[model samples]
Target: MRGGVRVERQLRRLRWKLTAMFTAVTVGCLLTLAAVTATLDRRAEERALDADLSTRTAAVALTACFDPAVGRITVDDDSADSLVLGRPYLVVVVDWSRDPAGAVVYPARAPLGPPDLGALRGLRPRVGPGDRPVLTDLAGPSGGWRAAVVAVPGEGPVNAGMVVLVGDPAPVREANAELTRRLLTGCVVLAQLAAVGGYWLARFSMRPVVQALTRQEQFLAEAAHELRTPLAALLLVARGGLAHPARRVDAMRDTVRLADRLGHLVTSLLTRARLQAGTQRVDLVSMRLDQLVEQVVEDLPGADAVAVRAAPTVVAGDPDLLAQAVRNLTENALRHGRPAAGAAPVEVTVRDGLVEVRDHGPGPHRVGHGSAGTGIGLSIVRWVAELHGGEFMLVEAPDGGALATLRLPGAAARPTRA
Candidate 1:
């Protein structure tokens, strides 16, 4: 018999494997999706901020006027006020035509006060044509700013120039951070759900294995219980034979019978195991039920004490297995029927694919007392009958004894059922 601890360990291993697999796959997919979404969202936020900066720069560039002869340029106050309202950061116009490069032109003076202008001066050197906006990060005494410069044609002093627009990126950063937090929470929840689902799936899948193991345990336990009685009987008979040499022959016969019973019990267990494993193949062919019944009665230990009235009954089944079933039923009747002198003989009837063994004695419970052979034999007979899509019954006979019956699928000496 397999140890219970081994079985439990095997089940636990399978469950953990399933849980890990589920969590890895499910969490992997969620994290991948979250990463992709975050990338796309960051790009989108940057694009929208760039679009806002480009719109403000275009408005300033369109309104500004420059005179070539006077070496002067002018920009609209309304445009500068619109850029600063509901927004943070400072703007300055820069001239690329200067000999040193990155020379402030329109804002020739700082309007936002003399905070560190180095960050703004650095950005002017990188400006190009207004076809695409040039962006950079600027940090000064006022705080951080996301700045973009777009070059535009000027009338005179500032011939090639750019309108710079700057804004704080705190809101966009907050939105991205919030999305990341939510996605992480979703990943944790999905992992929990996967763990729960995977555990139940493992348990459901293991049910068949657990049942098979349990059945094997029961088979070993029951076999040991059943074999004890016959083994004890055989030992007693051997001891008696040695003590009384005059009755040694009779004692030896009893010992042989007990040995035979023990062999039958073991064979029954092995056969059941083979059947359950599907290793024992049944050869179903056309055969006579009565012939098998008569053979069983003849082979029974106390055949002379039983009477059989069998008709020509045909059936479709494995001939060997059917014979075994009949033999088991006969043994059950002889061992447990408890017939007295002059009592009606144990009657076996076979007709129309049905076989019945009846004894004229009290019912099974009274007659089956102290007999380990009682239940196993009947169980085998019932199993055999059902294997061929037939039925077996154990009920009270008309003579007040137990009646065992088998109904197979065929007519008497006729073609078998399809």
Candidate 2:
């Protein structure tokens, strides 16, 4: 019980570790993807903002006229106002030729307060490679601003004049912030789903390991139980032979029999272990099932007491395993089938890829009534039959006793002798 609890605890720990690993990997990947996506989106938004600023600056520049006679730059108020309306920008015509001051022609009143005139005077109307207005970021007491400066075509006062379109970048900033929030929210949701899926997958993967461990524990406990009785009996028999000189011969004979039984039990255990561990491969081959059965019967202790009626039954199977299964069945019948000392002989019949062992014993209930060994032989037989795509069954005989049947898949028919 303590071992089982320990195993369960270890399994639980392993499952949690696996789940954590899966969740961590998933979350890491999601965070990377979200970061990349946010970066791309921010760049796209900035590019769009710059494009709009340049277009608006060009439109404002077109409306401005430089009058050298008045030594001042004039802009069409209606056209500039129409462009600035419903937009988060203020249009200003800067006369660099003057005291670096300009007139704000649009919006009559600024929503985010007036423009920073000190900063505006520092602006230079520069064009890029394609004569595109150079946009610049301006810091002001009100907030952040993006400005595009385009020079009017004609000259007026000293330093000429330039159309400066100042835009409030609050909307762009808010949009980027919103996108970040959504990305974070999506990441959180996906991380939770990944954790849940990881846990479920861990549990699913550990199921088979748990079952195999449980089966191994059961097998070990049963094997120990089976070994204890015979070991005790052998020890007691050895002590009895030492104490009684007259029964020494009989005790020695009994010791030999017990040793043989122990040897058989050990062999059976080894075979089962090898089969389970896959160290011993079941090599399938075409062979005569009847011949195998006849060979097993001839090797038994009392071969004459086991009468065999076999036909030319051929099957595809591991010859060694099939022979062992037949031997186990015949031995089980010989040991448990007889009700009295002089009862009917155990009968083994092989026909049509089937081996039927019938005994004149009581029935299925009494088959292992007085047996000293654990019934692992029958289990071996069952395993072999299943491995060969066959079945093993123990049912009451029609007349009396028990009928044990081993059915195997038949091989293709062979050519008969001419």
Among the numbered candidates, top TM-score falls to 2
User: Which 10-residue window in model 1 sums to the lowest lDDT?
Assistant: 409-418
- Clash pairs, model 1 backbone: none
**Per-residue CA lDDT of candidate 2, range 1-418, in tens?**
9989998999999999999999999999998998898888888988898899899888877788777798777788989988888888888787655665445547688665677777776776353223357789887677788888877655423345677788888887788889888999999999999999999999999898987787688668667765777888888898999999898998898898778767877777777777766687889998998999999899877888987888898789999899888888887788777644565559888888888888888788875455545376787888888888888888888777888888887622321110
Give the Cα lDDT of each candidate. Answer: 0.73, 0.79
Cα lDDT tens digits, model 1, 189-290, are: 988998899888888988898888887776666677778889888999999999999999999889888888888887887777777677888899988878
Point out the worst 10-residue segment of candidate 2 by lDDT: 409-418
TM-score of 2: 0.88
| Error in Å for residue 214 of model 1 | 2.1
How many residue pairs clash in each candidate at the backbone level?
0, 1
